[model samples]
Target chain A: MIEFTMPSLGADMESGTFVEWLVKPGDAVRRGQVVCVIETQKGAVEVEIWDEGVVERLVARPGDELPVGAVMAVLRGAAEPAGRADKPSPPAAERTPRASRPAKPQGGPPTTPAMPAAGRPRISPAARRRAVELGIDPATLVPSQPGAPLQLADVERAAAHPVAASTTRVAPSTSAEARKQAMREAIAAAMSRSNRDIPHYYLGTTLRLDAALDWLEAHNATRPLAERALLAALQLRAVALALRDVPALNGWYSEGAFLQAPDVRIAVATSLRGGGLVTPALRDVDQLSLPDLSGRLRDLLTRARGGQLRSSELSDATITVTNLGELGMESVFGVIYPPQVALVGFGRVVERPWVADGALVVARTVHASLAADHRATDGAVGARFLTRLAEYLEQPETLWKPES
Target chain B: METGKLNPGALRKILFDCIASVAPEADFEALRTDRPWREELEIDSFDFQNILIAVSKRLGIEVPESDYRKLATLDTFVRYLAERMGAAG
Candidate 1:
């Protein structure tokens, strides 16, 4: 039996919002098959299976905020005896599976016919819910026969559109209020778990930004307006590259097992839904060009802030970077987002004292606070990662050059 | 589209329009100044952030999602706009 736990996509991603499950109990899955989608604030990403087996059970559901290492699904051998119940049990709190959870006031789960009619089509649980929300009948929607079984679009056309009313509606009501409450509840649950379960050790380092700014100003002078991007991307790219030298920081920790991941997925902490948080990934940042990285970051942040991000965008992260600088926060000691070994927090850039030529000099510097899982990375490893990152940022010229 | 000068009534209408666009079935009449909207409105975190886009479009101002959380109620939300537009002062 192989436990298909929620793999940490990035270092700072302590928790993830379950976006969707690709397979159900009894479905055969091969290694490297994209099995699930998790939404991080950065964007949606499909998670590939590391182990091959038949999905025995799905413990979590869409919209569930699960810790990094929690078992999302259980996989068993094809020939393994089925559990006492072959049918997947619904979530304990709700009788309906996440995919089929009714948006309407239905008291219980929907009943499907024992057998399908010749023309009646099958639909996914998610698409079914979407159909319900849109007041569409899922049974009428044709399931995709070529490849994927069901999707939102399949369900969308099946149902008639709700009565279109003028934009002017009344003020707040129970529906809106209930959604807000649910979101708060989910956030509170995730944060409490992260703070309590994760062992966080914070180290603050102030990096001199004078040289970096000089280099950036010169570089930007020749670039286009759209090319001018957030300073955080440069900081993130540097940190990501530096992680290669300090491999321990680019990994995950679960039970007594410590694992190193070759690819680096950085979660850019983004503010969402007026009050909530989301971390979208900038995949393989080390390989992307400066303009490309900046553009991707802009798009991810726009979707994150705008709430158009799909569920997969929110979850798959291997590391996280939180920038409080935009909020005018001088410094913050971030809670290690779990499973991933480290989180780097960037504080506001301010003029500060620096040592140059054995004398105290005033220079603009940004304070970087790194929080690491004490169980995985030692202080030396964390320090080396930070030092190398700082060096890269200070020498921004290397970032513009094409990699060998 | 001034940075912050929308009338209180205009802002209220805008807020209502925003919610109505997303969840049309949601009852807006029940929302009041002290309704604890986070519980009463069912406005999930995503919806709350999406409102910023609407608010920005209506007011011609870029309202940060993080800043919107501080406005807890419909009345407070309107008041926030009043302040932003310098109308309240």
Candidate 2:
């Protein structure tokens, strides 16, 4: 039997309130299927099960605040012994909602199927839940093909129409000032630990992106808006590939030692529409092509805003990147997220005075800065990372054309 | 006589609806038509692109990335989109 526990999404997240269970007992779950949702300071994050199995029990009830490592569900895998399938959890007292807080009412999960169709059309279970979440009537949706099961894209298409009244609604409880206050507190706790413990060293430099901007313009000229790559993707790709020469700055500072991360996961600093921010990771970024990376980045931002990020993408970050150029700031120095030793900051790309080939000219340049933990590495190592990053950005052709 | 198709007021409504869809927290009543909304609204480049994408999808008109600067304010945005969607719209 496999015990699925509440994942520690981040240092900022101490616990999460069980929002909904996508699966119930006796349901056969596939590997990588989103099994449930947990509401953290960030938002409603869908938690995925890594192992394929039949759900034997659900230990955590909806509305229960479960701490990190608390068992959420039990599953009997294909290889496991059949007899000991149902491992009963301890009584309600021993479950979540610790002594510090009162046990809230176990309300029905938010996305209850409100439709009562006489002969409902075939719809995927995930799509059904999503339709209800958007306050959409599942019966009104059409499948991709006639007589086929309705998919999430169909619900998305229906929700995208401006005439849908339900699409405009935001949950009062989720968007309330109280939730913002809670999020602010969570950020304060994590940042306080970062400042108190990490001996951070800051560095900055201006990198020219004239070639990059020119190439981007030419590249996007022929393509439609949906497939066009953003400069942010190139910046992230540069940082990820640059880490090859500066692996020292890519991992965590835990237990008084520096451990180089295996994969280059870049946690993007995304600002939520409601209020706060979340730095969710895009895994193995170094291996991805620019187009693939751009698509994934767009999807990540969309999901982050929609309050639908996954749990596995939340916690594990080898490094963080913040781009505040859109806010019109020329430069910004960010505080490093603790355990992760480095944070990269980028100012907006702007037209500025520069000397190229011994002639004065205006060039598009971005102010790139690095904040590193001195304990992990000196300023020189961080400086080298910035140098390599600029090298990648300056040669815009190599960034995309030599795409693996 | 189909004034609604090319009307500035209709264009503005479409634009605001797209913005609201992308950034629900936008205070529409206080939003100024003459201001460069990126800095004012705290919306990043991608979010703004998403807004334009939605607008294009609604009206079935394409706006190139280079033409993004032409839409500095809500007024300019409506005007630019109105130009793309002329009498035939």
Candidate 3:
């Protein structure tokens, strides 16, 4: 009989859900056929069969969360004698609620394996417990030999024995440590390439936000209890509408040229409340109405705080917007998210001193800054784009009106 | 048990639900049985494993990773599993 254990789907995955099975017991399987689908931290994938066999039993079921390396099924040759129905069942001992485990005193050996005495390997119970904690398969821990009895000493010896220091390592570089290093390296490379290879230009402007702020306050006056921060929503909508006229800022430079996309995929840089940063994309922002944009922004913020966003939502942003208004900052020079050619920074909309028609005056104003990639864009182009965007922001009425 | 008895709709629903749970925002039609799961869902290595684990747990089946890397789509997943479990669909 061949034991079908939970395989590590990726370097970082420690456990997975048995979402569904494509096959049932007594089914004939051929080599290279997917027998089951497992849900890991990443996503869903179909797992295939190796040796042609008949699935002897079904082990896990939908919603069952099993640790990586746990045995979930058993496969035997087409004509092998059938084992008992409970043959592959995990021993009752393993079912002991984790809350009841005996506390270890100064790490004097680990807990025993949950399996019964009969099927237990020859290794010490303490070693079995330690192996479980380490997520190491005891069977695999012992060297593969025809009939050698496994022991704790053998496991310890194996642990002590290090790979030949001088021998060239032949294994693929995909271990957890290696993968983490690769991710960091990728981020570093992208940052350096963007900063060095992509010529960037910075432009700053301050615009009065009294009308927008007034609109937000009046709109929220009749809103539901849960509706607050309507001003940010309006600002985001304004920026989205502004991008429709400034199409050149809504794309990335790839393959030695700027690739203009049809819709503006704007990324909102949201800092999780006392947590990590997440940038969820609001696709085709130019098409969404003001109310729709407000609803989506609320939803995105909620999901970002709850840590519920999928992997795809976290990648591939053409442009990013960071609002420091909530943080009470007046202005900030934004750093460009890699592969994105531009980033917009917005500051608090506070009443500040200004001169109008050569007379000193106090007027409501919000500071804004735009960082553009100078590699594919020039000062003239950036100025024109910013000019069009500012015109939309200052007028505000024409932004919502559809072009006929 | 009789083989080839599982309804295609039932199986398809089960499969799609499993995928949607993991990637709620993914375009379902893009997750065609004809396309490889990775290409169809645009799943990376880590996400791929999580999906595999969910499939295994939900279906009461165990899929070895070495073998799973060979499957490309929904059809292959069913066909291979049918053969392995000694059933037909």
Q: Of the candidates shown, which would achieve the greatest DockQ relative to the real structure? A: 2
Model 1 chain A worst lDDT run, 10 consecutive residues: A96-105
Candidate 3: Cα lDDT at A5: 64
Alpha-carbon RMSD to native, per candidate: 11.4, 7.0, 24.0
Worst ten-residue run, lDDT, model 3 chain A?
A: A97-106
- Chain A agreement with the truth for model 2, given as TM-score: 0.81
* Candidate 2 C-alpha lDDT tens digits along A1-404: 87888876665557887755667678898866888877776666788777778898888875688898788998888677866644433233122211010111112133323223334555666686677577676666767688677788888887887365234332324434556676677778778888899999999999899898888888888987888888898899899988877999988887788877777878888876546777777876788876788889999887766656776667667888999887898888989887788999999888999999999999999999999999999989999999999999999876755537
The Cα error of candidate 2 at residue A184, in Å, is 0.8
The residue ranges of model 1 lying beyond 4 angstroms of the native Cα positions read A1-174, A310-312, A358-361, B1-89
lDDT of 2 by residue, B1-89 (tens): 12345577877888888888777767878988899887788889898778878877788767887898898988898889888778445
TM-score of each: 0.54, 0.83, 0.47
Q: For candidate 2, give the lDDT of residue B53.
A: 81
Error of 1 at A226 (Å): 2.5
Which is the better candidate, 2 or 3, if ranked by DockQ? 2
Q: How well does each candidate reproduce the native contacts, as fnat?
A: 0.00, 0.78, 0.00
Q: Please rank every candidate by TM-score, starting with the best.
A: 2, 1, 3
Give a tens-digit lDDT track for model 1, residues A1-404: 66666654333446656655657778898755667756432234456775556887788776577897788888885555645323322122112111100011111112111122232233565674464355443334555455567687655544433222111111212243454454455555555656776777788888888877777666566654445545777888888888877878876666666666667778777654334566666777888887788778777776554434433334445677888665667887776555567888988778988899999999988888889887786787788888888888777876556652
DockQ, prediction 2: 0.68
Q: Which scores better on TM-score, 1 or 3?
A: 1
Model 3 ranges with Cα > 4 A deviation: A1-190, A357-359, A402-404, B1-89
